[model samples]
Target: MQAVIMAGGKGSRLAALTKDEIPKPMAPFLGKPLLEWQLEQLKRYGIRRVTLVVGHLKEKIISHFGDGSTLGLELDYVEETAPLGTAGAFPLLLPKIESEHFLLLFGDIRFDIDLARMERFFLEKRAECLLFAHPNAHPYDSDLIVTDGENRVTGFDSKHNVRTGWQDNLVNAGIYILSRDMLRRVPEVKKTDFEKEILAPMAAAGEAIYAYRSPEYVKDVGTVDRIRAAEEEWRSGFPAKRNLEFPQRAVFLDRDGVINRYNGFVRTPEELELLPCAAEGLRQLNSSAYLAIVVSNQPVVARGETSEAELETIFNKMKTLLGREGAFVDDVFYCPHHPDSGFPGEVKELKIDCDCRKPKTGMLRRAAERYHLDLSACYLVGDTTGDIQCGKNAGVRTVLVKTGEAGRDGKYAVTPDLVADDLAAAATKILEEQ
Candidate 1:
């Protein structure tokens, strides 16, 4: 696949480091230029052809990696005689890119991502544009993204935008895969922003713009402090070793009490009702870097009160309700085994101890493996002691919400790290810590 690196910016924020007549992308990082590191990563990912859009100190970049042969890449250059904003350089390369879709990235960012997976997602969705989004340390002052249940980009909020009471923490990571047709949206003006002038407007008009939210390592070293942190992260080998393999953080939840009213076991779709603000609570996580996962104990399946197919229908209805509110859960895992017997229609085989049941950590471990999660970095939110114990056993932080049992008369083997009134409040606590 082809990739475009926008290396023309003067990077005034990093002026101290780039004061030696070198562009920000050429600034020294760990004994080599930052751009060289990025090129090596691209080459490692099997991307051999790259186009460098150069302007500021263009000669330095050209002299260092001329024709990209030293890096085993087919190099091309687009010299912007005058300043064109982020998306402006793209219009100039419309005639140069032969592929229908090409990767676009900013030169100032440092990241270790699975580009092949991103490409597959972009193709699977048939999206006109797909942006890489993640949660940063400072969401309050970052460009946030608003997406629907399907990960479609519904709105883009720049950092300058006034804060609403509660917002999603997912921010644009400054990487994208753009279909050639998206070039039509680029303004004819010499200078224009890709976010402000192109992508946001297209999304506002209901175009197919999606956000690929992952917990992979993507950081912009635009300041001194961040550059230092990036170097530290690299030296620690956390980004290259763990993040590249499985880096998503998750918020594990209990189904009945946490997501819906818990009068009794929900036997049918018609009986399911969402708890107050539950959809909104999940919507916040849906737009953040955390994966919304449901780990529930459903003993009724073993008692023959509810069949697996019927349970799936109920979950689907719940998802539909959440989608109406622009919310969603990434995955759901339920344990159907019950350690009792002698019920009238009980499934004899399932009435035994199972590892996936609550308080056993099996479900959480499975999720950790499937999504490449770091258990310690995850959080488990539930209304019962079993949920808290499950989280503790899995080595994740735990929160107890008062919506179900109210944390009253609770006799359990473990205590929650925090307690909240409901799911929404629990989400607030989690984001505050972030």
Candidate 2:
């Protein structure tokens, strides 16, 4: 697939490093230019054709990469004579991109992403644009993204909108996949921002814009501090070693007690009710770097109280409710096995020992493999001893919430790293710690 990299920034924020007329993308990172790392990552992901938009000191970029044959890429350049905003470069390269979809990225960022997987999600959703959204350390002054449960980009809040209190922390990760048609929405004017001018208006106008939320490493190296952090992340090799072909961090959640009201084995969709602040807590996670996963023990299937289909319906209802609040869970895993026997109406086949049951770490381990999670860097937020044990068994940090079956003074067989009043409080703690 073809990719476009915006490499025209002047590096005004890093004057010390760029004093020698070097572009921001050409600034050194671990003895190599930041754009070099980006191109390498794109090449590793099977994207060989690239169009670099260059402005200030454009000769350095063109001279360095040239035809890209040395890097095994077909390089193209769009040297703007005057300053054109993010979306302006698109119109100039309209004829070059023959594909129906193309990837767009900022040149000054460092990331390790599964572009193939993101492409699949974008195609499945039939979206005009798919933005990469992640939580950063400084959300208070960052542009926040609001997405529904289905990963639809419902709204965009710029950092200037300070009146909206405690919104979701998901920020635009400066990466995107856009259909050719989407570029038609960009004005023919000389300057336009992809976010403020194009995307925000389209989303508000009911267009299909989605967010591909991931925990994979995507950092902006615009400032001095961020450059150092990006270097450290690259040196540690944590971004490449974890599950899903890249490092991931997750927040394991308990479904019944933590996500929804604990009403003694909820068997039907009508009985599944979300607890207060449950959606809010999940909304926070939906935007953060943590993967919000629901790992619950639902033995009702073994007891024949709820069929697997019925349980799925209940989960669907929960998802719909969360979507209304712009909250989401990346995945849900439940253990339906029960070792006990002789219960009336119990499914005999399900009444056996299973590894997926809570406290055994089977579900967590499976999730780790599926999502390429780094267990040691993850967190489990739940309300029971079994949940705590499940997280500990999976080698992740744990947080116990005073909700559902576990009250404020409840005791657990094993201790958690932290105790919170509810899921919302637990989310605050997790973000703070991170």
lDDT of 2 by residue, 1-434 (tens): 79999999988998788885899999999999999999998998899899999999999999999999999999999989888888887778887798899999998898888888888889998989999886554556677787665678878887787533234456799999999877677647488888888888878887889988766678789987889887887787766643256667889999888989987889988788899989889878866667888898999999999998787678867765676567777777889999999999999999999999878989999888768788999999887887887788889999888888773333446889999888988999999997
The parts of candidate 1 lying over 4 Å away from their true place are 187-189, 242-370, 373-434
Q: Estimate each model's TM-score.
A: 0.67, 0.69
What would the TM-score be for candidate 2 when compared with the true structure?
A: 0.69
Clashes of each: 0, 2
Give the per-residue lDDT of model 1 (tens digit) for 156-219. Answer: 8787988643455577999999998777666463888889888878889889999987767788
- Cα displacement (angstroms), candidate 2, residue 85, comes to 0.6
Which ranges of candidate 2 are over 4 A from the true structure?
A: 187-189, 246-251, 254-370, 373-381, 385-434
RMSD of 1: 9.0
TM-score of candidate 1 to 2 decimals: 0.67
RMSD values, in order shown: 9.0, 8.2
**Residue range with the least summed lDDT across 10 consecutive positions in model 2:** 161-170
lDDT of 2 at 54: 94
